[model samples]
Target: MATGDAKLILPFNSAFSSSYWMRWQTPVCFLITVSPGIAAALMLYRLKRRRGCDHLPAAATWAPCFRGVPPLVLPVYRGLVVISMISVLYCLLRLNGLVEFYFYTQWTFLLVIIYFLIGTIISAHGCWVYYRQRRRQGVEEGNRFLTFNRDDNVDNHTALVTADNNSGGKLEDKRAGTWGYCMQIIYQTCGGAVMLTDVVFWCILVPYMSSAHFSVNLVMGCMHSLNLLFLLVDTLLNSMPFPWFRMAYFILWSCTYVIFQWILHACGFSWWPYPFLELATPWAPLWYFCMALIHVPCYGAYWLIVKAKNTYFPRFFPHSYVSL
Candidate 1:
């Protein structure tokens, strides 16, 4: 039945052609395809209005202020949302037979684009809710730690301070320790490196790999999965206050991914980005297991860096930093 439908929708020669129309039609197709997403967004907006928070803060607003650095939610969301809209447009064009040439060759691209747009929109909405709470409570603008009184001698090291920085006395801005600052720099560096590498791999490497019969959709899926996993871990680590809770969250989330991968693999599917695992000769599950293990060190390094900043450079990493 699927085969008959494929033939009806896509012709033999048109399916395999390599042309500009095939490659570039995605954005136009995505715009037309995003009706469901638009509908969903409108529905959500109406629901929120009905709940009585007319001026509710966006989800990005509640993102934990890492020291003074506002969470990088907006940029990420903007990029993903744009890509998703493009994907939706692409799907619409393909389904409607708007692009005559090479339609079959680009089917996988359509699916990948759709997956990304949907996933990012869902995740971004959750983040929006988080920031809204912070904005409404006024905590979004204050230091996450060390509440102080204006009348107190804030300079005195002997005095204990509240984390909220809202005590009756003037708040003292404590300098972060040298190690903490160093960690912050390292975390930022690592985060940047990971993102840059992933982008390069997707935009450049994947096309080359596809020449060898690599599944682009599969590769994209894996990459997106990895990205989601990393972001989830990073968010928890940076947002949580206590070390124990941070570690616990990391473990729980990591285990969840492990289980998800395992189940998918057992069911004859590969759901992660590191294509090396799927490309292995023996098809060992252990290879995928090891790939996941790499996250431990990556996250561990990130945690160490954040921990150092919090411990050493408290003033530099104030909790009150907000970015629009």
Candidate 2:
């Protein structure tokens, strides 16, 4: 039966000859992959134009909803950084140094690490600002107490106080700038990529498609599980908003990987990391279409998780937790 199965399936190839393009499945598969990518790009463009840069609040980049302090989320982000880096390094060493980075699992894992790294830096800055604000606030209160009811410098003092208050308010309300948005885009992209990577690996690939090229092992298990686990913890502790519009970026991430795989094969590198991604099969179009559509649910699952967090956190921890 194994030999019969091998005989029935088309062998993997590296070169894309003229006949390869001539096949109906080839063009259809290309269309399936390219169409979503184009649509996602346009959707992101329109969203940026319509919502403007300030749509994602700056406070969310640093602050934790469960607590009023912006710095409270720092430890969680730092832990994520350490764990993700160690997991990624272990996978690379266990599999095949740099070559293992070719898998989407590595791509998503690296992306998660990047998000946490950026989050940690931003959180550290938030902590500094938080402490500075506290010190200034104490000094201001002391000054007010000492100068209470003084009429000697009333006008000058009033103007100076007003100016100082305005400056502090502006600083506190600072916008999330370009880097903040970049961090957010990566976070949301990782959300979907993590889900897709795990679901495909555990549900479909493990059951039906496992082989020598894609073996089941501890390293691979951690690659799928830890990505989801870390991100979930982040989602719970961090104040970042998970907007549905950001799903566009996730689609583009997956599409970019597909294009990368296609390019590698065109350059004579045979063997797909995931069998469903092969374009040579007659069912290629179906696989491509299904993969493209799967992004919705994969993304939706994470979005729902965020929604659930926001919904139930306040109810459960009424005193300590607040929704983002």
Candidate 3:
């Protein structure tokens, strides 16, 4: 092949070569993979400081206290930072005539980033509402101050509190406050947005038309199935009270998805959903396999971050009186 042909083939060809796969995937993969470890460290740090702080302050407060700006400001600032970086990179790629390559992958990659940006805004607004309410109640009485001690070993804490206990001995059900209601709305809205986006992308934008010369439905369907499994496991991990049980569930879910993918591939079907995986070369399967491996770790890190935030951040934890 000529040099131009080689240039065209390299990325796909390198996918199958173990050494090349490691070199290109490791940097970003490692950052995403270790995110959970970083989150764990942060969680421990927060726990250590929990005794002195009454209610866990909003993430926004910690951001500014830890840095110079308030924590709420950080997400917006970070979003702008990401936009700036993408803009700079886009310009550089345009100058290099690599912009066309980006267009091919933009449907999925760009949309994923956009979804996160929107989700972050919703989360920030929820945090603001939560913090304002906490401020009104005063810190000492706030629920944020309660911290889980690893050494406590109290099994009774896992018992489900009844509506009566939650109501402070009152028989009537308490009404949730404006902030609490708003937070629930935001959570449901974000979840809906993600589901809608995924539907459009998988069902419409990337659909497998009979004329397209490939089984788009099979590939996309399998990928979406795997994604659903991931989402289910992630939700269970976050909601489950026992950490060990959550870990076990996650492991089992991951293995199931991996096995399903292999079975599909061995049966002569393309199980990878991403459009980039549609190539005919041997490299295509290998690349998808690497991606599947990388996806679990990246998502696990995200789960850890979200779990820690809800546990350590005041805004996410619900209050008893607020319901009234």
* Every model's TM-score: 0.32, 0.82, 0.30
* Worst lDDT 10-window in candidate 2: 1-10
**Model 1: lDDT of residue 131:** 54
Per-residue accuracy of model 2 over 138-253 as CA lDDT, tens digit each: 65542331122334432211111222664653221235778788989999999999999999888997888637444565566776788898788778877788888889899888
Q: List the residue pairs that clash in candidate 2.
A: none
lDDT per residue for candidate 1 within 1-324, as digits (tens), equals 011112224223332223322333333333323333354456546654674222211222223434244444533753554465455444444444443112211232333343334334433553553355346445633332222333444322212222343554333333333333333333333342344334435554556554433434433344334443444344433422222212222333334433444344444443333343333334333443443445445455555655665565446544543211
Candidate 3: tens digits of C-alpha lDDT, residues 1-324: 011111212122323433433444434433433444455456546654766322222221212222122335545643563464356335434433442232213222333344335434644664464465447555533333222222334321211112234564222112234443333323322232234334545565455533343333332343333333333333322221212212322333233433443344444443243343344444554654554454344445545655564455444434310100
Instruction: Give the range where candidate 3 is weakest over 10 consecutive residues by summed lDDT.
Output: 1-10
Ranking by TM-score, best first? 2, 1, 3
Sort the predicted structures by lDDT, highest score first: 2, 1, 3
All candidates' lDDT scores? 0.37, 0.70, 0.36
**Top TM-score model:** 2
Could you tell me which 10 consecutive residues in candidate 1 have the lowest summed lDDT?
A: 1-10
